[model samples]
Target: MSPRLLLLCLLLMLPVAALASVALGAASLPFGEVWRDVVSHVTGGGRPAQITGIDDAIIWGSRVPRTLLAMVAGAGLAVAGAVLQTVVRNPLADPYVLGVTSGASLAAVAVLTLGPAGLLGPLHLGVPAAAFVGACATLALVVVLSRHQGTTAPVRLVLAGVALSYLLQGATSYLQLRARPDQLSGVLFWLLGSVAGAQWSDLGLPATLVVGCTAWLLLHGRSLNALAMGEETAAFLGVRVHALRLQLLAVSALLTAAVISVAGGISFVGLVVPHSVRLLIGSDHRALLPTTALAGALFLLLADLAARTVAAPMELPLGILTAVAGAPFFLWLLRRDRSAAGREV
Candidate 1:
C-alpha cells in the first residue's frame, strides 16, 4: 500500500485502538457502557451528577491518563528514534542510543532509592526533574566527546553513547543493590517501566514536547534526507550540517527526557516502532516520521492494553512486554540485513 493509504488506515484504526485500551483492563467494562461513559464524560452530561461509581473513576481517572501517556510517550519515542537513525546514519539508532534513557533511569533510580528527597529542593517533582537533568547532561557529554574541530562525528557519537550507557546502567544497578527492600521493588518496577500511575496532569509536558518536536521535525525532512546521504552531501545541499545535527540531538534528547520522565524507562517503542513504520511506508522522512508517530501511538496503546489485561489484576511491566515483542523482530531485522549483504557480496 502507498504511504497515504497506510496513513489513512492507521488514522481509522487509532480510535478503535484507543477505545480498546480505555475499556479493557483488570475489570473489563461493557463496550456499550464504555462508549456511554466516554460520551458522558466528553459532553459533560449523560450521567447524573449525583450518580458516581467505581466505573466512572476507573474510566476517567485511571484508564484515560494511562492510555494518553502511553500514546504520547510512544509517539515521542518513535519520532526520536527516526530522527536519531537519520542523524547518525545508523540503523541501530534509537532514542537511547545517545545514553539519554540510561541517564534518565539513573537519576530516577537515585531519587527513588537514595533519599536526598529534596534534591530538586521544594519543587517535589524530584524524579522527573533529576531525570531530565541527567538526560541533558548525558547529551552534552556525548556531544562534547563526539566533537572534533567543532563538528560531531557520528561514529564517535555512537561510541560515546554506548560507553555512557554502560556506565550509567552500572551506577543504577549499584544503587538498586543498595536500596532498601521496600524501595528496591519500586525502583525495579520503574526501571522495567509502567504507566499504571499516570495522571491527567502528567500528560501536558510530554504531549506538548512530542507534538512540537514532531512538527519541527516534519519541517526538517529535507535536511534529514540530506544528512542521511552523508555530512558532505548535506553541506553541499546547503544544509548546515553541524547546526542541524545539534538541533536534532537536542530535540531528540528533550523528547526522550520528557517521555521517560512520565513513563519510566519503557523500551522498544523507540527501537521497533519506527522500523515497523518504515517497512510499511518507505523511509522518506516526511512520511516516515509522521506515520511512525501514528504507528508508535497505536502500538503502545495496544501494548499497554495487553500489559494490563494479560495477567488480569496483576499488571505486567510495559518495558517487559515491549522488549519481549521487539527483541525477536529486531533479530529478524539483523538476519535480513546480513542476508542481503551476503547476497550483494
Candidate 2:
C-alpha cells in the first residue's frame, strides 16, 4: 500500500481504535456513555477522582493510560529495533537481543520480592528504571567484550549479548525459585511483562525519550545510511564511525530500557514492527523511522484493546498478545532469510 493510503487508514483507525480501546473493557460500556465521559474528560472535566462514574474512572483512569502506554512502548521498541538493525548492520538485531529485558526482569523481580518495604522509589521509574539499568549494564558489558581497536564488531556483540542473556535468565530463575508462593505471581508479571498499571504520570519520560530519540535519529539519518554501506565507507564519508555507533547504541539502549521497564519486555514489537516496515517502506532510515513509530503505536493500541477485553474480568498480559501476534511474523522473516541465503549460495 502507498504510504499515504497506509498512513490515512491508520489515522482513521487510531481514534476509532482508541475509542474502542476506551469503551470496551472488563465492564461493558455503552458507546454513548464512553463518548460522553471521554469528551468531558478531554474537554476539561473535573479531577479524575471527581468524575463520579465507574465507567469514566475505568475509561480515563485505567484503560486510557494503559492504552496510551501500549502506544508509547510499542513505538519506542519499534524505533529502537530499527536503529539497532542499522547501527549493528545485522538484520537480526533487536532491542531484546542484548539481554536488556532479562536484566530489567531480574532487577524488577528483586524489587518485587526482596526490596525493603516502600524502598523502591517512583512507580513510573521503579520498574522502568530497573530496566534501563539492566539494558545499560548489558549494553556496556557487550561493548566491553565486543570492542577491539575502538571498533564494534557485530558478531562479538551478538555473542556477548547471548552470554549475558543466559546469565540474566539464570539470575531471574533463581529469584523465582526463592520467592514465596504468594510473591511468585508478582514475579511472574514482571517476567511476562504487563501494562496493568499505566497512568498519565508514567508516560512523560517515555514520551520524551521517544520523541527526542526519534528526532536525533532523523537528524543523523544521513550518517546512519552511510554506516549501512559499511564502516569503511562511513569513515570515508567523514562520519565518525565509532562515535556514531556509541551514540546510537546508547540511545537505543535507553529507549528500549525505558519501555521494557514500563511495559514489561513486550516481545517482537521492536523486532517484528521494524522488519515489517522495512519490507514495506524500504530501508531509508529517514522514511522508515517515523513510519515505524506510528505503525508500532497503532499495532500495540489495538493489542492492548484486545488484551483488556479478550476474555473479560480476567486480564490478558499485553506481552502475551504481542508474542502471539508477532511470532508468526517472525517465522515468516526467518523463512525469507533462509530463502535469501539459499539464493546467495
Candidate 3:
C-alpha cells in the first residue's frame, strides 16, 4: 500500500476514533447525539433543546476536552519520538530517551507525595508547573553533560540521559515509598498517565506547540533525512550536524515535556506509533511525521476509550492500556530486528 493511501485511511479513521472516544465512555452517550452535539458546539450553534444540561456538561465539559488533549499529546509525543530516533540514529529511541519523562515524572511525583507547599515553600507550584521546570532542568543538564569539544555527541546524550533517568527514577521511587496511602493513588495515576481532568484551557499551549513544532520540523525534513544517514554523512552534506542535533534534541525535548506536563507520563505512544508508521510509510520524515501524528492521535483516542470503558466505572490509567499493547509490539520489534541482523550476518 502506498503511504498516501495509508495516510488517507488514517485521516478518515481519526474522526471515527474520536467519536467513539467521546461517546463510549462510562455513561455511554449515543454516537448520533454526540455527533450532533459536537457539530452544534463547533459551529457556534445553540445547544439542541432535547439535550439535557447533564449531557451537555458530559459532552462539552469532560469528554471533548479529554479527547482533544489525547489527540494533541499523542501527536506531540509521536513526532518527538520520530525526531529523537533520527537524531540519535537509534531504532529503539523514543521521546523519553532524553530523560524528559523521568524528570517530569519525578517532579510530578514529588508534588503528589508531598504537598506543593512541602517542597516549594510559599511558592506552591502545581504538579504540571513543577514537572515542566524539572524537565527543562534535566534537559539542560543532559545537554551540558553531553557536550564535549563544544559539540553534543549522540552517544554522550544517550549515556547522560540514561544516568540521569536512573538517578531521578530512584528519587521518584523514594518519594512514592514515603507517600501516604491516600496520596499513593494520585502518584501512581500521574506516573501511569491519564487525561481524566482535561480542560479547554489545557489544550491551548500544547496544541500550539505541537502544531508549530511539527510544521517547523516538516520544513526541515531534508536536514532530518540527512542526519538519519549518519552525522558524518550529514556534515559531509553541509547540514551543520552539531547545530542540527542540538536543535532537534531541544525541540523534541520541549515538545515531549509540554505533553508530559499536561497528560502525565503516557508512555508507548511515542515508542509504538512512530515505528508502526515507519513500517507502513517508510522513513521519509515528511510523510512519516504527519502520518505518525495522525496515527498517534487515533491510537491514544482509542486507548483512552478503552481505559475508561474496559472495566466501566473503574477507570484504568491510560498508560496501562498503552503498555499492554505496546510492550508486546516492542518485544516483537526486537525479535524481528534481531532476526534481520542474523540474516545479514
Candidate 4:
C-alpha cells in the first residue's frame, strides 16, 4: 500500500481506537453514549443531561486524559526510536534498549521516593525535569563511551547502552527497596508504565514536545536519510555529520524524557511501531515519521485499552504488555540480521 493511503487509514483508526479506549474499560459504557459525551464536552456544551455526574467523570476525567496521554507518549517514543535507529545505525536501538528509559526512570524514581524535602527539592526539580536531566546525561555517557577514535561504531554503541542500562536499572532497583511502603506501589506502577493516573495537566508538555520535535524532524528528513547511509557518506553528501548526530541525539533524548516523565517506563512502542511502519511504507522519513507517529498512537491506545480491560479490575502495567510483544520481535530481528550477515559472508 502507498504511504499516503496507509497514513489516511491510520488517521481514521485513531478516533475508533480512542473511543474504544475510553468506552470499553471495566464499566463498558455504550459507544453512542461515549460519543455523545465526547462531543458535548468538546463542543463546550457542558455535560449531556442524560449523562450522570459519575458517567461524565469517567468519560471526561479519567479515560479521556489517559487516552490522550497514551497517544502523545506513543507518538513521541516511536519518533525517538526511529531517530535513534538512524543515529546509531542499528535496528536494535530504542529508548529501553539503549538505557534511555532506565536513566529517566532512575531519576524519576528518586524524586518519587525522596518527596518534597529530598535532595532534588532544593533544585526544585519535578519528576519530569529530573527524568529529562537523567536521560540527557545517560545519552551523553553512552555516546562518549561508544566513540572509537571519535566516531561511533554500531556494535560499540549497543554495548555501551547495554552496560549503562544494566547499571542504571540496578540503581533504580536499590532505590525501590528504600522507598516507603505507601510510595512503593506508586513507584512500582510508574516503573512498569501506565496511563491510569493521567490528568489534563499531564498532557501539555509531552504534547508540545511531540508536535514541535516531530515538525523539526520532518524538516530534516533528507538529513536523516543521509545520516542513515553512514557518517562518511552523510558528510560527503554535504550533511554536517557530527553536528547532525548531536542534534538528533538531543532531540531524541528530549522526546524520550518528556514521555517517560509522564507515562513512566512503557517499552517497545518505539521498537515495534517504527520498524513495522518502515516495513509497510518504506523509509522516506517524511512519510515514515508521520505514519509511525499515527501508528504508535493507535498501537498504544489499543494496548492501554487491553491493559485496563483484559484483566478487568486488575489492570496490567503498560510495560508488561509492550515487553511481551517486543521481546520476541527483538529476538527475531537479531536472528534475521545474523542470517543476513551469513548470507553476505
Candidate 5:
C-alpha cells in the first residue's frame, strides 16, 4: 500500500480507536450513549439524557483524560523512536533502549520526591523541566562517551547509552529504597507508568510537543532519510550531518521528557510502533513519522484499555504491558535479522 494511503487509513482509524477506548471500559456504556455524551461535553451542552450518574463522571472526568494521555504519550514516544532510529541509524535505537527515558525517569523521580519546587515552584512544569534537562544531559553524556575521536560509532553509542541507563536506574533504585513508605507506591507507579491520574489541564504540553515535534520531523524528512544512510552519505548530500544529529537529539529528548512527565515511564511505544509502521509503509520519514504517530496513539489507547479492563478495577501499569508485548517482538526481530544475515552469507 502507498504510504500516504496507509497514513490516511490510520488517521481514520484513530477516532474509532479512541471511541472504543472511551466506551469499552469496565463500566460498559452503549457506544451511542458514549458518543452523545462526548459530543455534548465537547460542544458545551448539558449532559445527554439517561446518561446520568457515575457513568457521566466516568466518561467525562476519568476516561477522557486517561484516553487522551495514552494518545499523546503513544504518539510522542513513537515519533521519538522514529527519529532516534534514523538519527542513530540503528533499528534497535529507541528512547527506552538508548536510556533517554531512563534519564527522564530519574529526573522526574528526583523532582517528585526531593521537591525542586524551591526553584521551579509548580510541580507540573517542574517535573517536565527536570525530565527534559535530564534527558538532554544524558544524551550529551552518551554522545561524548560514545564518540571515538570526533565521530560517533553506532555500536559504541548503544553501549554507552545502555551503561548510562543502568547507572541512572541504579541511582533511582537507591532513592526508591530511601523513600518514605507513604511515597513508595507513588514512586513505583511513576516508574512503571500510568495515566490514571490525568487531568484535562495536564494535556497541553505533551499534546503540543507531539504535534510540534512531529511537524518538525516531517519537515526534515529528506535529511532524516539521508542520515539513515550514514553520516558520510548525509554530509555528502549537504545535510550538515553533525548539526542535524544534534537537532534530532534535542527534539527527541524534549518529546520524550514531555511524555514521561505526564504518563510516567511508558516504554516500547517508541521501540515497537515505528518498526511496525515501517514494515507496513516503508521508511520514508515523511509518511513513517506521521503514520507512526497515529499507530502509536492507537496502540497505546488499546493498551490502556487492556490495562484498565484486564485486571478489572485494578489497573496494570502501562510500561509493564508494553514491555510484555515489546520483549517478544524485539527477540523476533533479532532472530529474523540473524537468519537474514545467515542467508546472505
Candidate 6:
C-alpha cells in the first residue's frame, strides 16, 4: 500500500485496537456493554451499567491504564529504536543496545531485595527512578568516554555501552543471588515485565516524556535522514552533526527510559516496529516517525490484548509475549539476510 493509504489504515486501526482493548480482558465483559461503558465514560455520560463489582473495577481500572501504557510504551520504544539506528548508523541498533534495560533491571531488583522502602513501596521508588538514573548515567559515561582528545568516537561509544551492559548485568545477577525468596519473586517478575498493574495515575509522567521527545524527533526528521548517510555527509548538507547527534540521542534515551520505568523490559518493539514501518513506508523519517508511532502503538496494544485474553484470568507476562513474538520474526529477517548474502557469495 502507498504510504498515504497505509497511514490512514494504521490510524483507523488505532481506535479499533483501543476499543478492543476496552472490550476484552480477564472478565467476561460483553463487548456491547464494554463499548457502552467506554463510550459513556469518554463521552461524559458516566459509567455504564455493570452486572457485578469486579466487572466495574476491571472495565474502569485495569484495562484502560494497561492499554494506554501499551500504546505509549510501544510508541516510545519504536521511536527510540529509529533514533538509535540513525544515530549509531547501525541497522541492528535498538533502544536497549546501550544496556538501558540492564540498568533498569538492576535498579528494580535492588528495590525488591533490600531498601529503605520495604517491599511494595520500594517497588515504586527504587525501580523506575533507579532505571532512569542508570540510563542517564550510562549515557553520560558513554558520551565522556566515546570522545578521545577531541573527536567523536562512534565505535568507542557502542563498545563502551556493550561493556557497561555486561558489568551492570553482573551486578544485577548478584542482587538476585542474595535476595530472600519473596524478594526473588519480586525481582523475577520485574525482569519478566507486565502492564497488569497499570493505573490512570501512572500515565502522565511517561506520556509527557515520550510525547515531548517524539515531537522533538519529528521536528528533526530531515536532519536525521541526512545524518543516516554519515556524520560527514550530514555536515556537508549543513546539519550541525554534534548538536543533532546529542539531541537525538538524548531524546531516544529519554524515551527508552520512560517506557522501561513502567513496563520493565520490553525488547524488540523498537527493532521490529521500525523495520516493519520502513518496509511499508520507505525511509523518509518524517513519514516513518508518525507511521512507526501509530504502528508501534497498535502493535503493542494488540500484544497487550493478547497478553490479557490469551491466558484469561492468569495474565501472561508481556515481556514473554513480545520476545516470543518478536524474536522469531527477527530471526526470519536474519535468515533471509543470510540467504541473500549466500546467493551473492
The weakest ten consecutive residues by lDDT in model 4 span: 336-345
Local accuracy of candidate 2 as per-residue lDDT tens digits, 157-227: 77788788898889888878999999998778767667878888889888899989999999998899899
Per-residue lDDT for 1-345 in model 5, tens only? Answer: 688798888888888888888888777788888888999999998688778868888898888888999999999999999998888777778997678888888887787677786324675447667877777788889888988988777778789999999999998888788778887888888898988888888899889988998999899999999888778888899998877887898898889888887888887888889887776677888788889999899888888888988898888999888888777875675566664324421
RMSD of every candidate to native, in Å, equals: 2.3, 3.1, 2.0, 2.7, 3.0, 3.1
Q: How far is candidate 3 from the true structure (C-alpha RMSD, Å)?
A: 2.0
lDDT by residue for model 3 over 1-345, one digit each (tens)?
Answer: 588999999889998888778887778678788888888999998578778889988998899999999999989999999999888787767767779899999988888888897656787988888888788888889999888998888888888998999999999999999999999999999999999999999888889999999999999999899888778888889898878888888888888888889899999898899887776667889889999889888888888888898788999999999999777876676576664335421
Which structure is stronger by lDDT: 2 or 3?
3
lDDT values for all models: 0.86, 0.80, 0.86, 0.87, 0.84, 0.79
Instruction: Mark the regions of model 1 whose C-alpha exceeds 4 Å error after superposition.
Output: 46-51, 116-125, 330-345
Q: What lDDT, from 0 to 1, does candidate 2 have?
A: 0.80
lDDT over C-alpha atoms for residue 160 of model 5: 94
- Better structure of 2 and 4 per lDDT: 4
Scored by TM-score, the top model is 3
Per-residue C-alpha lDDT of model 6 across residues 1-345, encoded as one tens digit per residue: 578998999988898898889887766778877777667778986665553557757887788888899999999999899888888887777866777677777777777686736434534565677777667766776777778887655677678778888888899899889998877766776787777788888788889988888888889889989998788999999999988887777788888888887787877799988877776667889998988888889888888888878878777877788888877876676565564324421
When summed lDDT is taken over every stretch of 10 residues in candidate 2, the lowest stretch is: 116-125
Candidate 5 — worst ten consecutive residues by lDDT sum?
Answer: 336-345
At residue 51, candidate 3 shows an lDDT of: 86
Model 1 root-mean-square deviation: 2.3
Which has the higher TM-score value, candidate number 3 or candidate number 5? 3
Residue pairs clashing in model 6 are none
Clash-forming residue pairs, model 1 = none
